[model samples]
Every structure is written in structure tokens, then in C-alpha cells.
Target: MSTPNDNPVPTVRVLPETLHRAAAEVFGGAYLIGPVTDQMWERSLPMYRASLVQGIVEDDGVVGGVARSWEVELDVPGGRVPAAAVSSVGVRADRRRRGYLRALMQAQLQTTRDNGALVAVLRATEASIYSRFGYGVASTYATLKVTRRRAVLRPGAAAERRLKMITPEAAVRELPAVYERIRTARPGTVSRPSWWWAGMVDRHLHKDRPVWVLCTVDDDDQVDGFLLYTVNNRDGWDDPQQAVVEVLDLRAVDERVELALWQAAFGIDLSEHLLAHGRPLDPVLDLALVDPRAAVTTDVEDETWLRLLDVPAALSARSYGAGEPVVIGVDDQLMPDNSGRYRVSTDGVQRTDAEAELHCEVGELAAVYLGGTSFTQLAAAGRVRGSSEVLARADALFGTPRLPWSGTYY
Candidate 1:
């Protein structure tokens, strides 16, 4: 094991292979695993970027590392724009608190900016760690635990569509169209490339051989939505009645199809409970349930963390609501170029020489950029500093008609 003081100022390098190995090591340490294999590394390489991979070397060995900026389009408030999805961030167990993580993050942010990505987004391993790096919770997800016995569709709910149970192979071939149709409908969603589909989506689907893929088709026989799940049978186990139908992935174009999918999951025989994890904040299931409490939302968590690398481009990409212009001062310590006063309005965004009505960090701005949280909420938390009138105006301008949701996890 390496000690922190062995190499006080660790050397940083961009080594894709070394970073990949070090990442596996960091993850093994993080998850209490002894080691990770090359096969695992090969499987995840589709999402890996050699240029974006950064590592800290000690005595010619990678001691800490991070990978990021997977080129992808993110659905912002009214439009889709280029974004860099940061992931696979980790540090060696023995290299903690040595500023390696901070150095890597700083380098990553600069690389993300240089890549011309308007925004930097991540699914944080630890919520507390990213906030200091100027990443704020940009989207939220809800976990649903529904009691199967009480999970009944509302009387007037739309009749079930043409649902077909297809093989995982078919699902891998067919579901991308359905996903593409709905990916941009919500803010914070990022496009899933073919590589992502194979490496992440298909890999998971193939893991559980008995996995069920239910596709919903329109009258014209066009695929609109799909549900990927598996059932646990505990016939000989102690709690025979405790079988669960777990939802691995569920996507639909509209509520009707979504309800149909939920009904199918609930209607699974011998399953006493239906659990859906990482669902959007919208309570479509709760509203469809005969007993609202049947689909109990056990937890809600931050799903997307966003950092503005280029404030001007980030602000300009998303459309704002109809409101008077407001000049807001942004303080971005990590990327000082993003620190400036910007006048935002429904018309557009631009750097302003005028006095600022509000002041906030880049993270705070990102928190409200997607319209998931309002300026008032951030102001209440002391994140946004402004007068009452300015806050109200900023809220109106930045707010969205629908809540921003990132349905896809990269």
C-alpha cells in the first residue's frame, strides 16, 4: 500500500489504460472487492475517453484517478445541448485527503470546458463531495415500493395497449427507438449512444436470463414504450408470499403507456410487491393506483448533479420563461472565466456591464438552470443572494412548465 507522504506532490497524467486499471482499483477499494478483471474493464470501455482520463502517479504507479466528459447531448429546458457527463471518479484508499481528487477535478473541469461542452453533469457517488466542486443537484428521482395486493389501476384508466413479451435480444434491437422518442421530452436527460446501449443497457438485460421485456405498441404496430424487469420466486423459501417484481427499466411516450406498463408489473402472478427504482419525480403510478398509498414513494434523491463550465453557453442553450431581464452575478472559483454578470430574459442571455441584482455560485445557478428547483428555494437556502423583487423575476424567467427530470442514468 502506498503512503500519502511518499510522493507529496503527485504527478498527474492522461493515461487511458493506467487510469482504467486505477479506476478499477479505486472501485474495488470503494466496494470492498479484492480485484476487478480486464473483462470488466473491456465491457466499460465504450463509455471511456482516453483523452479525458486523468490520473495521479506515485513512483510510476497510478495512485488516484478520474475519467469524464463523455460527449453527449443533454436535454435542457426547451432544447437539447451538448454536455459532458462526468463519471468513474475515484481515488486510491491510501491517497485520501492528499488533494489528488481536487487536482483531478480541477483538471477535469478545464478539460470539459476546452471540449466546448456547455455544461458538466455527473451522478455523484457521494452528494457532499461534489457540491464543493461546484456541482449542484440538478435533477431528482423517486423510488416506489408498491404493495401488489393494493396496486390496482383506477377504474377509468386507459385500457391496456398491445403488450408483447419479447426476448432480451429483441429488446436490445428494438428499445432504442422508444428511448429516443422520449429522451428529449424531459430536461436533464442525456442521449444514450449505441455504445452505451450495448455496454450498460444490454449488459444488464442479459445478466438475468429470465428477464422479461414487455413492449407496448400502438394500433399501427409501432413500438412506443417498454419495460424490462424480472420476478423473484420464493416458493420454497420461508416467506413464500414475499416475491417481488423488480423494475429494471421502464420508459414510455405518454402516461397511458406508462400506466399500462405499471399495470402489467402489478398483475404479475405470485409477486406480492412491485418495486421501481430511479423513477422520475412525477407520481404517475400514485395517481393511477386505486389506493394512492399502494404505490408508496419510499425515497426521493438527487439523480443529476450539474456544473456550469461555460456559463454563457449554458445559459443561452436553454429557453427561459417570459419575464423581465435580470442581471445575476456568478462566482465560479474553479473556472474563473464563467464568473461574470449575465442578463437573462425570455429574449436571450448576454454578458452585462450593468449592476447585478443577484449573486450566486456557479453550482447554485446550475441547480436552478434546469428549472428543477426555483430561485426562491435556493435563496431560502442562502445559495442565491438577491432582493425580493429580483428573486421573483429570476424565478419567473428560469422556471419551467414541467419539472426537469433526467430519466437516463449514464
Candidate 2:
């Protein structure tokens, strides 16, 4: 009978510059996204080639499993820190059950930490695959639906909003600056790179459907916010009567500006329905409507899976809510440097030698890292090991004024 020690470790290697497309090819098939064409690879090279790429190589010198990440600045509670925006993670169909996935994840994480990134984040295609790798659901989003005809703003709901319509090319030129100004409003926001902007506009420009960018300008003629969307017929091209307006992206300097943009969406001439995909679970949109029931939330799920590479550095970067200090212990199997006791309070976080009043694995700790979940909630599911008093203190210390939202989808 074979035992766990019978098998040998799979070889994982960093792909040379010429073999980067092999990583993309494996990922394309593993995800079943689309064909790995030269055009697509060229579009993607700007994002990851300058960084690093790793994979498991087969006997023929082709990649069987691949993982790669891009660099970005992550907005924490009080400030922004460097983060690895991971993507293109996949393994070939024949490579399943041989520890390729585990090897790729471990190597990538070690490389991220060694390269000085404190945190890493990714949007998972499968929920169960990442937790064992110390990745947790740090943010969640929902698809918000609104019947356009039924969405009527309350009196004085939308202020004197000044807006302008622009072509896709103009939006590509202007909206990144707008996003930069408003991204600080949320804790989990990330900066979009030039590649992100270029890809976005190119896709919209080449499509048959029309895309519009509506911007709200302030009294001084400064661009305060914008919404990018396209109108589509849900039933079919023949049934143009059922027009659905899909908002791909929206950002605002404040709630008033955001509310005005929603109002404009409702005002689009001939749309029957409006859908805002991957939005934070905020009631502001519902409240602005006269009935508050006009907007319904659907498909609420994980938005970003966050993993800490340098736990102490990640913890010290974010600000916490008001609470007394509490000692929390984390046992990280993958990254031993992250295994320690951390004392946290409104003042700051510090490494402590005191006895831990609460205990959890590194993944479990990350689940509450952005205040997206609470210790009391996790304790109910037996994920948190702590008394009621200590659990409450920990929750208070990690809480944020608003839920963390990573608006950018990689």
C-alpha cells in the first residue's frame, strides 16, 4: 500500500521570457475561457510580463499548471499598501490530483513575500480551492437590479447634477484620473493600471453595442465622478424592446454624486431594466428611490480572496476601530513567518508575547481582516476559538465604518 510519503514533490519552475505564452495557453484551457490567440497574449503581456510568471513543466517542456500576478496599491483603512493582484491561475485537465495546484500556490506566495509585497488578492473561480492556501474571502459584492420605469427619485434626491456624455475613446482618456480621486473612499479599492484602461476601451470600442461615459462636473468644472455602461437587449437582437442597461463601472466623490449617476441611469431614454454588477452591498441606491424596493440584490458572493504574505506588515498598515487591546494568535501552516501573537487596538497593532485570548488559523484571521466578517459570526460556525467577551473586543477592534469594497475586477 502506498502512503503519503511515497510520492515525490512536483517540479515547479519560473518560465523564461519566451515560454510565457505557454502559461497563458494552459490557463486558457484550464479555465475554458477562450482560445489562446496571439492577439489576446499581446493584450495581456503588458500586465504580467514585466513582473514574474511561474508554472509546473511537463516532460515535453510545456507548462501543465500556471499562476501569475500583477502589482497594485491596495487601500486599507487608513492608507494604501502594495499588493499582488493575482490572476490566470489554472491547471491542465490531465494535471489534476498530482499536487500541481498546491505547488504553484506555495511558490507564488513565497515569491510575493520575498519580493516585499505584504498582501495578495485574487477573485476565485472556485470557492473551495484557495482556503487551504491561506486565502480568505475578504470582500463581497452583489448584482443590483432596478426596473427602470419603476425607479423614481424622491424629492430633492438628486441635486442639480451637471453631466456630459463622451465617446469611448474620450472615456479612456479621462476616467482613470476620476477613479484615482474617489478610490480612497473605500478600504478595499485598488489602483487600475494603464493596461487595464487600454483593454477596457479596446473591447468596448470594437463591440457592436454602444458604450457611454456620463460624467458629473463640479461647479469649478472639475470631473467629480462617472459611470460607464452599455445598453443591450436581453431577449435577443430581434426583441429590441427589452433593453437592459448594464453599468460596467461607476465611481463618485461622494454619495450625492453617486446618487445623481444612478438617477441618470434611470433617465436613459428607452431601457426597461438596469443592472449594476459587482457592487458593494450598500443600501444607498435603494434608499434614494421613492419605494426603496425598486432595487433588488441578486448573486451576492465573494469579490476578492485576500492572503497575507507579511502578516505583521499587513496588520500594521490598516487602522482599526475603537476597542481595548486584545491578544490574537494565528497559526499559519504555509507561511511560518506569519505565525505569531498580535496585540490590536484602536491605537495600533503590535507583536506580543502575552498569552493569546483568541485563536484562529491564518485564513480565518484574513476572513475578518477587512471587517467584512466578524469574530462573533465566525465563532457561531466554530471558526473562531474565543470567549464571548474577547470575541466582542476583537470584532470591535477590526470593524470599519463602511464595508471594504474592491471595485476593480481583475
Lowest summed lDDT over 10 consecutive residues: which window, candidate 2?
A: 1-10
TM-scores of the candidates are 0.91, 0.94
Candidate 1 lDDT by residue in tens digits, 1-410: 23365545555666656456676667667546557677776766655643366667677565665555577788998888888887767777776787778778888888777878888888877788998889989889988898888888987684559988888767767677668875546788887776665665555544553577888888888777888887666452356367777787888878878888888787777777888888888767777777999888868999999998889988998998997999999998888889999999899999999999999999999899899998889899888899989999999999987778876776
lDDT for model 1: 0.79
Q: lDDT tens digits, residues 85-129, model 2?
A: 898898999877777888889899988888878899999998988
Q: Give the TM-score of candidate 1.
A: 0.91
